[model samples]
Target: MYVSARERKLLERLLADDRDITVGELAEELNVSARTVHRDLQGLESVFRRYGLKLAKRAGVGIRLVGEEENKQALAAELFRLSHHEYTPEERQLMILIALLEANEPVKLVTLAHDLNVTVATVSLDLDKLEQTVEAYGLSLIRKRGYGVELAGSESAKRRLMSDLLFRHVDEHEFLALMKETIQKRADAPLDTVAEKLLGLVDRKKLAIIEQQIEQVKEKLPFTMADSSYIAFVVHLALAMERIKRGEAIHFDPRDLQALQATKEYEIAHELAESLEKVFDVDIPNEEVGYMTMHLMGAKWRNRQGTMMEEPSLTVGMKAQQLIRSVSDKLGVDLSTDRTLYEDLVVHLKPALYRLEHGMGVANPLLDQIKQDYAELFAIVADGARQLFGDIPIPDEEIGYLVLHFAAALMREKKGWRVLVICSSGLGTAKILAMRLKKEIPDIVSLEQASAFEWKGKDVSAYDLVISTVPLPEEYGPHIVVSPMLTEEEARKIREHLERKTSAAKRMEKEPTARRNKPIIDTMKAVRRISETIVHILDGFSLEVVKRRSVHEILTDACRRLERSGVIVDADVVVEELRRRESLGGLGVPGTTLALYHARSFAVLRPSLTMYRLDSPQTVAGMDGEPMEINTVVLLLGPADADEEVLSVLSHVSTLLVKDEQSAATLAYGGEDEVYSLISGHLEQFFDDYWISMKE
Candidate 1:
């Protein structure tokens, strides 16, 4: 099984925890089967054994590597070479400066230029390049006026950059030489003290073993400056470890670490140490702990040897608590809602935290389960953060986890509405109707299947809406309806009835107005004139016109004409919105009608008759199964604020067409006189008791 580079990198990340990882977990992370992971593990084991290491696995447990520290360091170096190519000298120099700037608080541009011996302009350009390069890795370059450039992103991204670029490439012999040089440069007492501290970390046997390995490797290959720098890092790591073991609180000069010219890894390690302390209440001296941890975890590959060791169960309850604390602090939320909630959250976070700590790859099952259980809580968190933070700019992973917590909270609080749908028969047509209704009307709380017989017994009135295959029982009250098919006519009628009922309720709440006679004739004349102007403009174009054009085609043609005439700015944008609306559902009102809305103050109603020759007869789905071949189009235009009035008129016109065949035929072939008469007749009856009587 020859693994690809991506697979190999994934395996390396999995092994970074330097502990046991299950085949199932690996398979889940890689989106593959357990058998495939097992095969990959077997191949890795063979490679390990060939390098004088063993791949050990326990049944019901997972796989891991075991070897001496020095050999592990060597293996880490080799693996680093294989996994990541070294940066060019210029890239390395820029990375070094970036690391320094990030590590220090408020590093000034002038100060950085002075340190790097480069022009300020060059520094600026480098910062710009760095900003662009870091984005893909989920990191950002933060430029604060007067504070200089700093790296901002996740702890994981910081660790990866440090480990891949700085620590892994250092040769053992050169690392030792660098350590000796550092000691020599320091005061004798301090140097001796640091050396002793480092020596104390290893016992006599281990010390001899490490020294011999370093000596042998040096003899085999001469040390380079890069190797020496790495040795200095190792010595610092060992010293830090000894101090940690002794429970000594030690702080070294930032300048000393800075002197090694390994600021990138040093700063990363320092940040990691600080995070560990803040999160876990466990402090390690310097960032050396992070560096040493990486080396130890990736050591087998460093030495080109294989050692099989039972994978350690690195799961730590403390670590989970630390993660929870860190996240809460970052979010500025009181996540500790009592001992039990805190404990449960930590338990939920255990697998992910452990994986993060050890560089092991672990799927976030607990987070997923929490999200599944508490969707509303997640929504609230997102909403709350968005309100407070303005954007709540978190990565998807954090969002996903936070959503889970939010949902759980909401479920506990019972904050949102609960809707139940009652529909006749758990069969095909009812299911389709229910689905369509749900999609069309998002305000409905829930949908459930209930037969007419079942509906009588259920609390039908409690539900938001109910659809039935047969007419509901009288006992079910006015809450029920029969609609086996979710046709456009049925949906529109239901929506319109709801709107009218809502309007009537609002009207009842308002105070009575002084009555006055509305000039119905004048308004009708204005509407007709505006309609005529629109028809004239549309007909003026030479583009091919269809008698019964679909709303989408009409809008597209209208937009093209608008752009050609320079009548609209960003016509393409409006066209896109029109197309999108059409995809949702056709925007056409039933009957031989076209409506145009304008935001300007003037109301333009003009009517003109023009014949559109259709290439082929187009069928429009209209009410009453009336297939309309509308050769004559009646275009209506008005101020955008009059949209409500326009909609009401269109609705009334549709009703008239459905009830009166004469009105439809009159408009289809009516000359100017006939068209005017048809519109006036309908408006008189509609306005008489409605608009005119309301004004009076």
Candidate 2:
């Protein structure tokens, strides 16, 4: 049976992907029109029939290939064996890159064209496009009429490019399957797939040895290495050994080497190198060990026992705070108190900044999906990263990670559904995945985490849903599989699963004889609490024009007014409390002419937000620690033992201070009625959301 290039590509995607792929998606992926994909499907029907398979198409949903496993394997094997002269543009380009990277000497255009079964002109066009890609890796593609072509760059750049290609093109399942095969068995036969072509770079026996060594060393590391990172590290070491055998060398900066030598990773890398030298019979250079150390340092870590802040750098901590504050201001949400978000960012940014500074890159496999799903949040984080990093060019991968951190923070709440998360380590990526699930699915009331090994025989009956990072055996029963960085599609599937279960449960239940019989007393009480808080603040709310030149004088005068208005018992005590809060961190909202001086004090009589506009702007330290001019001081006060409803209302007021440019301007310069109108409108919306959620 003849399988065309695009057809073969489509079939591979169908078999590899565990989700239904729509015609639009396939069309976009193949760079063809939907009609073209339909036509291709028409031709593929006969091939599927031959393999005892059928194409299942659902309108508005997608297409899926349905068949027995044996039939599917048979078709895959046949396709692998058939060697017809056809290649997609991506395949052809990848072949050319691999050929160039492998070739010690320049390869003629005629040779490349002949191998790819394409015209020299076609190969030249591919090179024209490929040049830009190679350049991004700091490699130059040398082309001449008579001299042929070659890739020129540092050995480190070449290695990185090769690793990137492997990670990008090779399916994770295929890689895992290859790893499962015995070294001797794999070495006996040459695999013919494009993935195998990349895998051929590392010797099978050496790859096994590297994996074994890394497995042994895993326990010694302070933080748990993600499964993906573990695989990448193994590939990295195997490739390094193969390259060393081929007389290729990587150069490390002497200064960088000196710095790395001080690290624990350096000591571990040295030991690993020594062990490899005896087994491979190759002298591992100090430079090679230094590069290995760099990889160790750059690996994503999730500490088990304590927070990532053990011996933290104040600089990175301050940057994390600055980034959080910037994003909070732009997003109009107060996330300053989210300790988990703070820890996650600090942990993520430490290795991330290291990778950025060293010109090393880590692949965020879900970057495109992240950008698609959280476009606005991604933009906010990208902007925040720029403001924090300043001159540093933070890649979208890092920004995608930052978005996950903030996205999780935004989703922080518990309501109804119960979920159990099973992960390999049950600490790092698992925590991230759990947070993402809760963030994406707010119905998740409680989440329980367990390692893969620990969850083998555990009772999961209490959980409403079970989700895992890795695939489980049939005995584990039914569960959804998702990446740590949950994709939109995965979230949709999870929600669908939950909806189906809910529908079934509703069907099984007896019909209610009457509806609306019970009054919503709790919701009524909640509404009353929120309403009273809003009323108290608005009744005492006053926006005054003050002439105080100093912060102390301004605070004293503001507190005296509050005391006289019966909002507080003692003006002196309230001023002291406000000053104490100011000393903890700057009250000035960065990049604005406004300051939010808020405190929860026992001396407070009621929750209130009062605006004091200064006659002359005065400089004060910003929340980000930068000095800024403030022409307005917004004093927000609440009782120390205030209820959740009162605190929620006060928090909403804090958000209004920097909700947006117009809101900030209104708070800083708008007349009392205009500002009060803005606050009332936002508070009304907040109450509506609260009421709706309560009903649900």
Candidate 3:
């Protein structure tokens, strides 16, 4: 059967593992679509059958390669021989563009198709994508009907495309190692051939000369240089020498060249040009020197000998702080104090801002990986970048690097899950179940016990695992159902569920970012799950669309309605407590247009939620000490002596709103019945994470 390299790797990975793997994970590993992987799996089934292996799948458990260990090994060996690897469309497009650039003459589309082993239509599609990729580097794919195609652009733009495409498919370290191996006569590895494919012909002799010249230039510089800068400088200079030897020249913007000539790096570039002229016997143009200066400006600085090698300009530093603060405000987390995050971002921005200014493309091989693994973090950073960079459009590659700093900081956070125990009998029964689980389950960080009465009265969405003693009408598996006595079978089942639910690490497998995020995702999943399941908590809840113009009237009306429904006895008592709480600080969640008015009240016999959608948003003092609008009011009232567990869940709900008004807005803006589902579904994982903190 026909199989791509990615499919081969997927099969090998599946065979080597004893458990199931998700299609999403395989797609990520192969850098393809999930649908693509699904297609590959279908093709793989017949091939696997050849070696007596079968693909077995179950819902939520993912897909597993089921067979004897010997059969798996045999299948792996067979796949190794049969996997005539096909490049992904992205890889093919990049190679095609490079091949086009290398071709001195217009080549036939059929020839290009044959090279890619694809049809003319596929080649055309690939070229369509290639056009955009090249255009970003200021080069155009010029197609001549009945003739062929050529890349039309300035020598400088073509050179930029060359350098970018060189790094796009491979890592910098790998490319460097390839050159070094060639220099040392150790170029026998398969990777050497792959490097050649990526870089075309490197002319190792020219690279060696530029490597020495760059070393000399580095020693003469005042600032500590980054390795990436040094390596890129060598390649750029080598290629420049090659182009000059061919009597070709590159041009830069006159203003940019004029500005570059004033820098120390350009002074060094001039001296280096003189040395290159002597070695390569070609006069290096001043514009090329400006090009080198541009490249130098984009080099990221590195620490040297335990000292900070460089601080970005004062403006860059201020921009960095502003970005960090913006992200902190968005996530509602104190990211500014993350010293490592701040320092690394400052380092990245020094070069990043310069790259943006110079319109240079920085190829980040990990960009796709970062996008998938740290999606939430990436969104926050990307959103913040817009305000700082304006509509300049920071490349996903640059954004990926920026995300790394925050991702690293988030990785430093403690990882685990929280527990919530629900018992229908009473507090004592709840305690029995909670204590047994706590004693047996070390993963239960903090345990809260509540009777079914209290659980229904409050939002129990803040806990990770909700263990119930009596039969729950709700089917919340991963919501362990066990005896209060902690029977051996029940314990085993709980342990198994906890492992599957909490340790997302096993499924993450190989990527560094995924490995780092396993615990974080696990924690979040727990909270999200609780939020999802808490739809029941909103059962018998009151909803209304109030046209009242006064916040006081809105509060009184909600309390009066809850009292009329017999959910709370004294409308006056609930209203007074809510008013008193509001007097301390506005209950309005800034930016959400939703106000949470909640209080522990003597007049409340049970926990109840009343939501009133205002006809229009009203101005109120924001929790952030600014004037903000509020349109949705959520009134929560609990008995004054409500169980601590009930209070805990209610408090978590408040905290959830305070930390992220956007999340609250998501819950508030949905349809009346849907609000309960949205709120419950979103908070499931938060409860899990709450348990984790308790463990701490």
Query: What RMSD does each model have against the real structure?
Result: 29.9, 11.6, 21.2
lDDT per prediction?
0.41, 0.77, 0.64
lDDT tens string, model 1, 200-277? 232222222333334433322211112222333344343443445545443334664343224233344454455434
lDDT of 1 at 287: 36
Question: What is the per-residue lDDT of model 2 for residues 167-236, given as tens digits with 9 covering 90 to 100?
Answer: 8887565555555553356575654566667777767677767877776677778676655566677788
Among all candidates shown, the one with the greatest TM-score: 2
Q: How does residue 624 of candidate 2 score in lDDT?
A: 64
Clashing pairs in 2: none
Per-residue lDDT of 27-129 in model 3, one digit per residue for the tens?
8878889999998888887778788878889988688887776887677656544524376666677668767766767878888888777898898888888
List residue ranges in candidate 2 displaced over 4 A.
14-22, 51-84, 182-184, 304-313, 415-442, 446-466, 473-696
Question: How close to the true structure is residue 100 of candidate 1, measured as C-alpha lDDT?
Answer: 45
Worst 10 residues of 3 by lDDT: 303-312
Alpha carbon deviation, residue 604, candidate 3 (Å): 75
